[model samples]
Target: MQALGPWLPDDPALPPVALAVSGGGDSLCLAWLARHWRKNLLAFVVDHGLRAESAQEARLTVQRLADMGVPARLLTLTTLTKGPGVAERARQARYAVLAQACREAGCLDLLLGHQADDQAETLQMRHQAGSGPEGLAGMAWMSALPDVRVVRPLLDVSRQALRNTLRGAGLAWVDDPSNQDMQAGRVRVRHSLREQDEREALWRAGLQAGAARMRRDDSRTMSFARQGTFRPEGWVCLGPVLPEPEDLSVLIRCVGGQIYPPAPAAVRRLQAAGQEATLAGVQLVRWRSGWVLVREAAAMDAYGPAYAGARWDGRFELFLPSSVSRESLQVGPAGFGLDRTVRGGWPARFCATLPALWRHGQRVGIPHLGWWAEEALQGAGFLFQPPVPATGGGVYGWPEARGAWFAAHHI
Candidate 1:
């Protein structure tokens, strides 16, 4: 309680919180407790509207919240997708809406009611799939949700214990029938007697072991990464990576964060950037033997003169400097493959939109290629270059303002 005091401010300073009350036993207990401890908490009942009684349940939940003196915000979600995965899609949409609501309500914290049993089920599922500790970090106690933070305070308390608490307080609760249906994925893990004890034990043990290994590994990786960033201490964000069984294959974080060891293949593709290549979502600008991942220009920037690689009307061999060719591309043929079609290099966007200034291998004005790259171009390939209608627009030039020293070449 003492350790958690910093998070719990005095009444006047207490930040409002958005509670995701599903009318489940777990969340009910959490709302009940939070309502008592915090004064300005709001209850948000998100009805996925998947079942026949979902709306009615939402109504009952609103009434219950009102009775408890916590104002309720009702949200309903329309169905998306179909078949078995429909439920998960609904869940995602529900959270998306809830997250937006929390932000709109001027609240940074969103509370959830997941308990220990849910964590156990997750562990069992990962164990069955032969996942290592990386997969078993388990549910986070608190995590970022787009713009909101999801805090699960009832994970340590059991569902049975919560029911006892609710009943002890003369409160009635509605049970979600979907939880008991064998069709739900989580139900199988709970009922699996044959694999239950052993799987549970190994996974539980592995989860702890995995956490320890990650801490150790993270410390070591961070030290080496800091050395790499010694040149520009605060300019770049390079630190230890999150623990994973395999090398980091894909990433979405900004550059200032830790730079995990790129896959051997991605490293090679980056090295062999004779023209342009896409790894993960970033475009690699290859120089003699060095390359840097750059955000491709924005879709609205307009494509400049076509790169020599993209201009090849027929098959042509392009020579590379001796130093640059020394490194073999691990990504092989597929790694270099990006659609150069004028419609847009990446299937996701149009090429005319990508910033044209970066490829010239020249200095750029925008520091982060602001608005230059809406999304990274995909389908970039070395051997394959098909000419399509080109996006004609004003070409990008060196950063006139910074007047920084850069290569003699321009893209």
Candidate 2:
């Protein structure tokens, strides 16, 4: 294995890492290498619980690490599908759990098992889809992934090297049956990525075009920040930020993609709703002062349930709605700060006194399920109500990056 540097690109210190191990050869190999490099590393194994022996595999993976004198934290979750789109839902859940673990552990860099082959496969798949430049860009080396920074150091490394490393270290991993299932889109893509040279050419062209577009997008995003004209919900009460008359849809897409850019019609409707009420979900809301991207039921905020009809006093349980949103409640005493964490436009001090309020959970909401309402709110440090100024936007109280332009805000 190549020696890891004292730092990841542009980062300082031998920062503690959180490795996302899946008990596969790829991830297990990564865990092995990472632990060898940094004593400060923390291993995080997530069991999707899709297979029968999934939890057992997780235990085994953890045990292997322990034998290496590396202890791991296991996070296992059942894949649930109430409706269609199980795959996407499962991915969202996985990342949500990983991000939470990273946060709790105070680890900054979250490492993944993606290697060059994964990138090639991704590029191949997207190219066939005739994807735009952005889509063809494939996996980024280091980027933000909800509550965490994701680093794919192996993007430059071949999969064979990872496999070889695992074997050399006497590690055995599982071969997921799903990978061989031709019915899977990715498997088909993998097969074709190996066969069609012409397709690979097109994909490479797409990647080049994508890189250019990313540069443009970065520029445009800077412009958007400077323009300071996107709003969805911070404490909401904003009008929609969509364009008028419906045809100029191009103006709605965000360069940063923090929220779903509303269609002109949707934007206008949300604008109307803000006056009389509020709209849920991530949408471009037009604030009277400006615009902000309002987050609704943000996938990153998928924690426990929301606290509805809950109490305070450090010993309470807030129940979540069966159909959940990103919004949550913080239970606490008076005089706590009122920020984005709580529900009402009110602060913690004011909202704490409310016999009937929680805090804002995240940037968005759907009200997941509030099944066991009675047993939950037995105690309360304080329900974190969603943050206020609901007319979404970070309260940096400064101009956008372009506007500020110190070069320190962003690289």
Clashes found in each candidate (C-alpha, N, C closer than 3 A):
21, 88
Total backbone clashes of model 1?
21
Cα deviation of 350 in candidate 2 (Å)?
Answer: 22
Candidate 2: worst 10 consecutive residues by lDDT? 388-397
Q: Give me the runs in candidate 1 sitting further than 4 Å from their true place.
A: 1-14, 193-210, 213-411
Write down the lDDT of every candidate, Cα atoms only. Answer: 0.48, 0.51
**27-136 per-residue lDDT for model 1 (tens digits):** 77778888788778888998887788988998898898888878888998875545777766777687768866876787777888876566667767766765544445
- State model 1's lDDT: 0.48
Per-residue C-alpha lDDT of model 2 across residues 75-176, encoded as one tens digit per residue: 978656445565667777887789778877777778889875676687777666655444456665556433456776665455667887777788888777
* Candidate 2 CA-lDDT value: 0.51
Off by over 4 Å in 2: 1-15, 79-84, 196-210, 230-356, 359-411
